[model samples]
Target: MSDSQLISDFFSRDVLLGDRALKAAVADRGEEALRLFIPEQEGYGASGLQIEQRLAKLAASIGANAVDYLIRVIRNGSWQSMLSAAPAFAGLREHKQRATEGLVDVLKQGEIDSQRLAIEALGYLGADDLAFCISEFAENGEWIPQRDHRRQPSRYHLDKFYFYVAQALIRMTASLTSVNAISRCLRQFRDFLPICDEVLGQNRISGWDVRFVQHNFPSRAADPLVRDWIASDSHFLQDCGVEALGHLRLSRTSAFLLSVLEDPRFNDSVRKTAGISLSEFADAGAAAKLAERLNSASDSPGFSWAFASLYAHDVAWPACDEFVEELLGQENNDSEISAHMIYSLACRGDTRAERSFSALNSQHLHMRGTGAIACARFNPESAREALFGRDEEANNPMELACILAAQVHAGHVEKVDSLHQALTTFGELPFLRPIWKREVLYAFFVAEGSDSERGRLWCEAALETPRRVVTEMQALLKRRAREVSANRLPRSQAELASAASRESQEVKDKFDVFISHASEDKINLAEPLYHALVAAGVTVWFDKTELKLGDGLRRKIDEGLARCRYGIVILSPSFLAKQWPQNELGALMARETVSGVKAILPIWHDLSVEELLRQAPMLADRLACRSSEEMSSIVAKILDVLKD
Candidate 1:
């Protein structure tokens, strides 16, 4: 059949999972094929592909040839079609008359998704002239859906249109750091601080995803509204503000959250959550302030105790060694809290950390088994022995799980193995207490990665574990994985490589592992790894075989790199020396935020952790499989993310 007929069929049919169907119809056409389709109720709403990746790839695929075709779809008034084709303008540097006009019409006449499309496209295409039209639509407030009062005030969720408009504005003026840009910031930070005074202001907060009123909000007018959602009992409402605060990391919030960290009015959960939030913005200034607070805070044990709940290694621990020692001597003697303090201090070269842990774990302090657990994070060599010695005693099962988590943080493979064997049900324990899953156990999967041996066990036990915990893990995994792309491939090279392949449409397709190796290791570890992956029923992308290399060899390899969710590198000496493989690894590392945060799983063949860290610091933090392990055991570890 002809291409026109195929495109017509795609849009006319109420196709679900259209990716597979489209791949069959025009395997060669790439994302350009999706645009050629005319209209259908829905074709590609939900698929295996992430919404952002799929949207981005489509925009990237639209060419001058498809501009007219896309315009036709926008005019066709299919919101689904408009969503796909509207982004065409984003890909092209040049504006087309017919297409630009059609999107404008959609903005004026269309409903939610359609209007959202026009707004985003205009913003992305940098349509300054039409910015007024989009702004007018937003200000008119016609899109706000009327709803009942059942959903509490300040807890109402708006459609994604508002976020799209805000994002569009950010994209359009991104080049300018002028006063106008600051003016356009629209009280994002203005209302951020008042929450310190209100402290979950009950009668005050009115709304968010709000009318946003105008381009300019009176600084404190937005205060109660911002404070309301931020302090909401609902996670969804709070996250809307929290995510924005974290991403913007405005200097305003650093002080605000720090104040929230110290305020006695807030409960432990709020204070600790604030501490974690403040930890994200931890700087020398913030650290110094926290330290000063620590020094002066002779009696505010709550301030110091909650601050130690998480020991992010990057935090520059305060020079308050005396303060920490003094706090330890007082009634601030919770074992778990003390353990986190010990681990964090030790990481920053505090000499008293080992001594602190020893006392905390001993009968003299009588702190529970928890101190050994948190201590393991910094010094697994010592924590592992203490953990094992208590195994014969009636130790807390949950507390032992905490120790294993500490070992996961330390990331010594031998020690990790020793600790896991001691715990036995390493994956199942932390999950039993759902609260700990967020507070304490997110470290378990983040550090080990959701594809490690422990992750595999976690996934297996997920069937028996509470659904909320499983859902939390999945969400956390995605959030941790998503970061800003620092992709190493220059645009020109990316254009000619796996990016431009026919498999560009295969955004949803994922293999278990792409065996990235230096060709030199095909004999020693690479070949065996490939066969082992295949034997374990893994969807291995070995590029078939080394000898089968052909003209499309680079393209095929690139496709494997792009398509695979995990890139298990055979990081041997030979692999480290090769420039192409290094670039491949760099590309994978860049996509860690864009694709999977823990995408690169290294196979340290004849490479020490120190050597790996020196050569590729990015991969060193990821839990790696060793080439020295038995092939079966290695593949079992590799399948951790997939097996469940």
Candidate 2:
């Protein structure tokens, strides 16, 4: 049959090839061919429903294979593609995991459209069990927005997927709301927070745009949703609702929100927000909680924001020793909150800050540096103990930076290291380079007027390190140091070379992924197929999932083929014309030959076996074919291979 005729037949009643034909098609062509038939086509009518029922029956017959095909179909298809194909595979498994995996895979892929599609499909699928997935994604606020071609300098980068997902959570699925309102409430807590406008600009007001701001504060002022949320026994959701009330900035919600703070059911975070929100309403009750929390044992750094927001600066001073002790425990405290807490302690200049800074050892660069800076600003003499440490880890660039800051602020020069290890060994993490940078600059200024050769080398090495922000600050410090230095020193070439080598080593080790797709066909189909392969012990190397931190699509594909078994190209029209996929197919074949394993698998949807080969001789040569006739056969194959 001609290609157009098959396309036409796909929409015809004759397309209902019964169970046997459906099985044959999937087994011969793969799941895409079976899924291509539009169930609601105009000509199929009631006969179409009957055909679908028969297809479902056939799918059940080869249930294991059907599951595999469903996995394949879900992983590859876009949100629209999933929406189109989901109903047929619903009865295949009621695990909730399959659907969640499909959505999470799309989100992880990081395509603006794919993320949106995944979110929208979650709503349409009407499965409440996937609510946690939605909540987790929403909390991250990392949704990347799609570029709009229609607008000149577009005003938005909305992910329609998330918007749809939110609507789905509220309107379509009862799993979250009905099963356990508490868990459901806790899951969406972040949704009510003061999200950055940058994050908000990603999603625009659509047809069913919910004025969540307004919804939290009804005009009648007695909405049950609002009331229930205010009185929810679940502390997590109540905390969120309190913040939601604050974000809405509604005076009407003040009483309801305040009432939550008094309820013993609410947690510390909720009571905190409730107090802050009620403080806006001048509710005397909120003031009491703030006072109580300030004096309470829960006065850890995590609640610094709540305290700061309430302008309880005086209350923060007493918690300094505890905060400093907690700070030494791990590098896990919220950076923003810790910064504020340290700053507050610095202003207090009490014995606690002095004792904390005095207790600093080489073992705790992060905490000692933080304490040193804070203490130095208030009591520079307190940093002398931390400054004298000789251990490389203890006397790293970060510790030196803080010690130097304290010395400069106090007008006292203590001990300065030679060559300053220009690449400070602070914290053992690459990402925390900036923190050490600040410390190094402060240390550079402290070596002023010193005749020591080590001081000169330290100055030169500090100048040689490369952080634009640190560089600019260093230039300013160098001028200040020149005024203080008894003898001027030129830049050290050996130190620069050593620093360059270390930076190069760090830069070269970055990770990445490679995606191969059929150009004309939708990306929707490729998503699930990629993920299922990943879940089924296949090391997937797709750009969407692999390269999260940066873009290295080509590099990733090449590297993946080098490391991965082989590439699975979705053999569609788009895949044929695209040079990337062709190149990938070539590489995959080469890898197969090298690895001595079947590499390129031809996955035909509606395309004939002959046509598929005609389109890509490379894929045809490498193709180790597997056919899926319907859901049943796909699941059967999956279970057969996936299970022992």
Candidate 3:
């Protein structure tokens, strides 16, 4: 298409039309088409801002040819577009000198909005040479008291122009020489604290902006200000204050932090933050005080136990044994709570709680896992016996995984062969719990420490396993592998063989399969399919079973995609309508481009291939099994695909 036609198409009101137009502009005309589309003045609304953002991204992608265009946008485009284009100018290495000069000129002569954009652009561009000029603007910039034309009226004392200047100075502080100038401006602005406080009081300013102000202040000046903030009525400020105090580690404020922790009226979150700050103190008294709080708040042990754990790690807490024992003896406490108490007691070399370990095996499934882990820690023989005993009878995969983990953690090298056999047998089953797969994998990786061939094989298998394991265990395995690799080198053929085995495992993906489906399809199709795959010994990421509370859904899903060998996207009308499933599919497709793997295994669910093509054409191209088929036949097909 011609540049003007592409530009018109790119700016079309329809989302899809705009996307297609932009693609054509970039693919065919490249930088020339992007330049033609840049808005010349401050008139385009939200849609215009989005288009400019896209243009900025495209301009950055084209490198130097788009630098002049981006500079022009900074000098003439709408305020929002100028802000959007500022970072693009920062990425131009070859034309930075010219871009810098242009931005400086805009700062000096452009309208207020343009000047603000220029200041921020200079910061991002790392124009440290203009730190003095920027500092001058920050200190003496006019505080226009006019209402914001686009948004609600305000009582903000400093205008948008000065706010951007302060923001720029904050960014500039990363350069050593800019620190003094920024600090001076910060002190000067301290005079406007009441106005800033009023702005904060009225909830007009972002907590992030307020934190920026707090973070830039010199510690000597910040100490008292943060101390005052801790006392402020605003819980956000109080939380920030506590966090700042923790980072500063000012010995003098230990008493103040202790006071915050002691205050019953303070929000639990603020108290929790204060407790974290207290944990940083070197004083043994901090541990004692934390213990006192743990004792007082028997009803709410989560934060108190967290603080106590931190304190126990930092200082010698001889008193914690009694606290832990008392807490453990209580029947009302759950297995997790009891486990923490046991762990704390064990940390102090107090094995008096070992008697309670047997009871954990009978508690909730999760508690039983924790108990198994503790058993491995406190008593290895018991852990090994438990694993052997539960190998055949344990129905819950997580519980079995935990027992296996205990066996590995206890260094049961002789049992590795048997464990591997058990794993193989378990994999052939029709329904394995997703958590069990992770736990078993984790145990195998952990137990791979032996120099035996079986140990090497287990390690190799773990290294080959894809992202089916939980993030924590994955990180631990990576760290352990690095430690193992760094500690020694192979000096013989046998050693070389061992090293080669581990090396060979790295080529394989961690997970055998990832089950992707809509939550609505859980009971009818997804659940049955997931169980079938697991029973057949495939590692799968099924959301119904894998996702835990407190996980960021998108982040967890991304991790699953990165680790899985194949994605089973169950295509249904409901699945197509949901944003998350589509997002997951998009991520899987992106991964395919990088990994050169045909990763998706689509399953048709009450939908025809034509219907699927209407929603996801690329996915429709893949061979798929129908949900209407016999469950066992479908499972067999999925197993066959995984086996290959």
lDDT of 1 by residue, 171-270 (tens): 4442222322322432222232233114334423222432121212211212222344455454433434433343332233444555556666655555
Flag the better candidate by TM-score, 1 or 3. 1
Per-candidate clashes come to 3, 52, 12
Model 1 RMSD in angstroms: 20.1
lDDT of 3 by residue, 515-604 (tens): 888888889999998888888888888887778999998888888777888888888988877767776876676454323236778888
Candidate 2: where are CA atoms >4 Å away? 1-263, 268-345, 362-369, 381-385, 388-644
Q: How are the candidates ranked when ordered by TM-score, highest leading? A: 1, 3, 2
Q: In model 1, what lDDT does residue 491 have?
A: 31
- lDDT per residue (tens digit) for residues 7-65 in model 2: 45433333222333555555655644544442222212212232334344434444445
RMSD of each: 20.1, 27.9, 26.5
Comparing 1 and 2 on lDDT, the stronger one: 1
CA error at residue 191 for candidate 3, angstroms: 4.1
